[model samples]
Target: MNQIIIFDFDGTLADTLDAVVRITNRLSGEFGYLPTNPETLSQIQNLSSWQIIQQSGISLFKLPFLLKRVISELNQDLQLIHLFPTIPEIIQQLQKKNYTLYIITSNSKINVITILSRYNLVNSFKNVYSGISLFGKHKIINQLLNQENIEPQQVIYIGDETRDINAAKQAKIKSIAVSWGYNSAEILLQHHPDALIAHPSELIAVIEQIKNPIG
Candidate 1:
């Protein structure tokens, strides 16, 4: 059975949470957004991205600029970003099982490719769709499906945020929310992803279940 697994790069594939927090905090003063304290971090992890943007006092107009700066800062710190535990092995296993993989991300393509190249995992994904709009990932997912000639039913978009789940839904595909990423389990559960996985190792089992829903 051939399947396509599209992934969100930042929190889903690479553990860039701490670095993002640091960058956002460092720029908070300049951007007029509230800096994330420990409490604020916990609070926002459970909130959707839009909610966070609202609470942080950042206008939608400034989000793109802010994100661009953040991504640029993140680029400078790419050496600090890395795959979550067991991701390499999981990717290998999925490849062995013949799952075609790709990445769709708001992060820059260079950033995604640089990290994959670091781990010698560049060949794992057939292609990458990067630098997507912060709120327009559904369009990218649809484009990827059309470009790849894959049906929504045969594809699953996996990510760590409620927006990702929403995008997958908007694109008419299944979503598996990962708890080990940006969103908390409780928050992700509320989004009602088709499957919610807690660890990288749990991915294979969930994919298998998606492949065979009755079994």
Candidate 2:
């Protein structure tokens, strides 16, 4: 079966947490947002993006500009970003199996592409859809579905955040929550993703199970 697999870039594919924290702390003074401490980092990992924004003291009115600056700073430190262990192999194998891959992310496309290209994994995804909005990813998913003329059942979105699972549910599509990203496995499970993956290799099995269920 031809499956449309949508992935989230930041926590899902690229390990940007530490780097993001460093950048955020470096810019917190200038942006008027609170600098994240070690404890706050762990706590924020469990919170949704919106919750994190509120806790960080960033005004909603300034979020777009903040996002743009965040992206700009992140791009400068692209050397620190990398795909999680075994991710390149998993993605390559999925591509070899003829799965249609796409990435919908809040991170900038330039940053995503730079990392993918660095690791020679740029060709794995068929499309890279990016946005800065902390909400409304479901709308982006819907737009992708319409653009490709595909139904919800034919696609599965994989991410490491609560928002990702929520967006998938809102779009009425299956979601695979990855444990290796921002949100903890426990938190991700609470969102009731169709599948929860602890490692990259589990992705192959989940896709197979989704495509060919046995009685």
What lDDT score goes with residue 135 in model 2? 84
The sequence of per-residue lDDT tens digits that candidate 1 reaches over residues 1-215 is: 47999999989999999999999999999888778888878889998877877788887888899999998999999999999888988888889999999999999999999999978888999999976487899999988989989999999889999999999999999999998878899898898999998888889999889878993
What tens digits encode model 2's per-residue C-alpha lDDT throughout 1-215? 46899999998889998988888889888889888888877888888766777788887888788878888899888998889988999998998999999999988888899899977888888889888877889998998999988899999999999999999999999999998889888888888999998988898999889778888
Clashing residue pair totals per candidate (backbone < 3 A): 0, 0
On the 0 to 100 scale, the lDDT of residue 60 in model 2 is 84
TM-scores for the candidates: 0.97, 0.94
lDDT of 2 at 163: 92
Please list the C-alpha lDDT of all candidates, in the order they appear: 0.90, 0.88
Instruction: Choose the strongest candidate by TM-score.
Output: 1
lDDT (0-100) at residue 49 of candidate 1?
Answer: 73
What TM-score, to 2 decimals, does candidate 1 have?
Answer: 0.97
Which 10 residues in a row give candidate 2 its minimum summed lDDT?
45-54
